[model samples]
Target: MHHADLFGPVDAGLPEGLVYRPDFVTAAEEAALIDHVAALPFAPFQFHGFEGNRRTVSFGMEYKFDGSGLKQAEPFPGWLLPVRDHAAALAELKPEDFVHALIIEYAPGAGIGWHRDRPVFGDVVGVSLGAEAPLRFRLKEGSKWRRFTLPAEPRSAYLLRGPARTEWEHSLAPVSALRYSITLRTLRAA
Candidate 1:
């Protein structure tokens, strides 16, 4: 694919600045991921606070993990070696165990509030699948917002690291259909 077609047009950066990768994941891979998750039982989204509180709300199903988090529901035997291991990437920078949160919603008009990943993690990774949704990122405490209108194509991934992870905030707009994201993060050492 041509460089321009792959990334499309370049857009202004967010307040903290951000990097954009249009084809983070291929369409075929995206479909497989969506199908896999769709087969799983839909449960209430779970939440874990920085203070060590764990809770589940009926409105959504969110999973929060610390250190020992795996990308999939069932662990793959030889799962995620250094080649694609996010934790390995983070280990280069900090010593804390990594944490992550994932939420899957099937119905339309469901959305998450505008918020930044807490300072607990050094960086954050967000992957979108099932249907296209518009993602907006704004500078923390700033009124201006930069939006990335991503197509709902399957297997799409976005990595927000460096200053973007540390200084900016992001959120998704309300939409119907199956939408889910796998988030990867690294916590600060105790």
Candidate 2:
């Protein structure tokens, strides 16, 4: 099916500084990326003071979130240079701007909780492979919360900046099939 047909219209109500591009990669490219990810060793995601079901590894910069806060570990793997470049171009960000990548693999029953990316990170861009999942967003209002949902389809890419990156919190629901995401982020300036 055509990528446009798969994603349909972009919602006008989506928060500011959000970009969703479907078919960011061709089927062949997606397949190859999936294979590469499968070959890599993935450890259970350890963050926010607890372990999670999703398995994750990093490139460019490894991220560790102890109970207190997030920290950078080893340098990003050299093998991920191509992917980092591709993601940077797609997001209209400079290659040097992106200094970290967090590759996450989620099983059928796994989903991420609502939360903002660490403040130390700048713009965020992510490529989705293997499965389609709903990416939801929520923002606190006076006494309520406003919400929105976007489908993160296979081969698609999404970018979050400005308010979308800082003020709002995003999450994914339990996926029905295996899904892989390569999330790239720039280091926030001091």
Candidate 3:
């Protein structure tokens, strides 16, 4: 059987509830955020018995993948209030609605695997900084899969909500250079 090349890369359209915006932050603002990130302490990301290559720090609420569950970290810092507000606006949510924040540092060649955000989280808003990486998405439909690659450019932001947030799984490709990202998540009400 011969496979059609057209079946591989789906350049047709993006998924629903997915919004991508380039140049979400100014150059000066990105630089300042990077400087602040550089000053903060970061710990190795821990998964279910594995240490991830990336370093991360969580604010508001930290979710433990070790089956331990969610725990509170520090409140959102004063410096991040404006950023949170902007991301919230893009996601059509209030800043207070985004109760969990994460700052991650990706070393060269470090990347995350395919996985969706936990069910406890409602929506995801992310800001990419310092460098660019491809954020890939996948959805399995029976025996077939649909995939899309999103370029997470520096100083850019994206919002994932509704079906995109629930039905699709997203991951990042390893970076060729050091990179930083900010993830703001809203919690689902019990």
The global C-alpha lDDT for each of the candidates, from Candidate 1 onward, is 0.49, 0.85, 0.90
Question: Per-residue CA lDDT of candidate 3, range 1-190, in tens?
Answer: 3242544645446788899989999999999999988888899999998899999999999999989899999988888888999998898888899999999999999999999899999989999999899998888877877878898999999999887899989999999999999999999778
Question: Using alpha carbons, what is the TM-score of model 3?
Answer: 0.94
Q: What's the true lDDT of residue 60 in model 1?
A: 16
What TM-scores do the predictions have? Answer: 0.59, 0.87, 0.94
Cα RMSD, each candidate:
8.8, 5.4, 2.5
- Looking at candidate 2, what is the lDDT of residue 167? 98
Score residue 86 of candidate 2 by CA lDDT. 76
Clashing pairs in 2: 60-76
lDDT of 1 by residue, 76-187 (tens): 2122222125433433433123334443553567666677766555555555666667676655234543344434334555656776666666667776665666555554
Instruction: For each of the candidates, give the backbone clash count.
Output: 11, 1, 0
Number of colliding residue pairs in model 2: 1
Off by over 4 Å in 3: 1-7
Q: Tell me the TM-score of model 1.
A: 0.59
TM-score winner: 3
- Give the range where candidate 2 is weakest over 10 consecutive residues by summed lDDT: 3-12
Clashing pairs for predicted structure model 3, backbone only: none
User: In model 1, how large is the Cα lDDT of residue 150?
Assistant: 36
Ranking by TM-score: 3, 2, 1
